[model samples]
Target: MSFTDSTEAPIYAGLVEEQGDVPAEVRRVAEEVLREADRAIDFGTVGAASAR
Candidate 1:
């Protein structure tokens, strides 16, 4: 249930690669945002199920 898994890791890496020349700060922020989004998705799904 993690975005860091084998399946998604390559896709994420590819995204970063495609965005070549991205600023260091921008890359850092992008990673942080993606991580937060992943966490939100995980928590939201769990919360929804628990509410059922």
Candidate 2:
């Protein structure tokens, strides 16, 4: 998914690069955070949501 607001290339190459090879549970939570951040960003602010 498109996470960052920038038009520049993403800092990390991919999800694997961003979160590393963590456990399933950790990865799940990380993905949720990413989604929430993206959601909040879409609404305008990074703090728009609790988990954003």
Candidate 3:
């Protein structure tokens, strides 16, 4: 799922909006990280691990 559709998106949006001075690069990196995290959560491990 896209970052905007993730659960954290609203909170992140609120924080970012409150911090109006956030730099463009920082915003870009933060959004990228969020998107990656969202993707990971959406496509996480599908089964229990075998005994190690």
Model 2, position 22, has a per-residue lDDT of 52
Candidate 2, residue 42: how far the Cα is off, in Å: 3.9
Pitting candidate 1 against candidate 2, the one with the higher TM-score is: 1
For model 1, what is the error of residue 36's alpha carbon versus the real structure, in angstroms, after optimal superposition? Answer: 0.1
Of candidates 3 and 2, the better by lDDT:
3
Worst 10 residues of 2 by lDDT: 4-13
| Sort by lDDT, top down from the best | 1, 3, 2
Per-residue CA lDDT of candidate 2, range 1-52, in tens?
4444234435533554677535666879999999998877675543566675
Candidate 3 lDDT over residue span 1-52, tens digit each: 6344337688656666677536766889999999999887854454434322
lDDT of 3: 0.66
Kindly give the stretch of ten consecutive residues in candidate 1 with the minimal lDDT sum: 13-22
> What are the runs in model 3 whose C-alpha is more than 4 Å off?
1-22, 43-52
Worst 10 residues of 3 by lDDT: 43-52
Backbone N/Cα/C clashes per model: 0, 0, 0
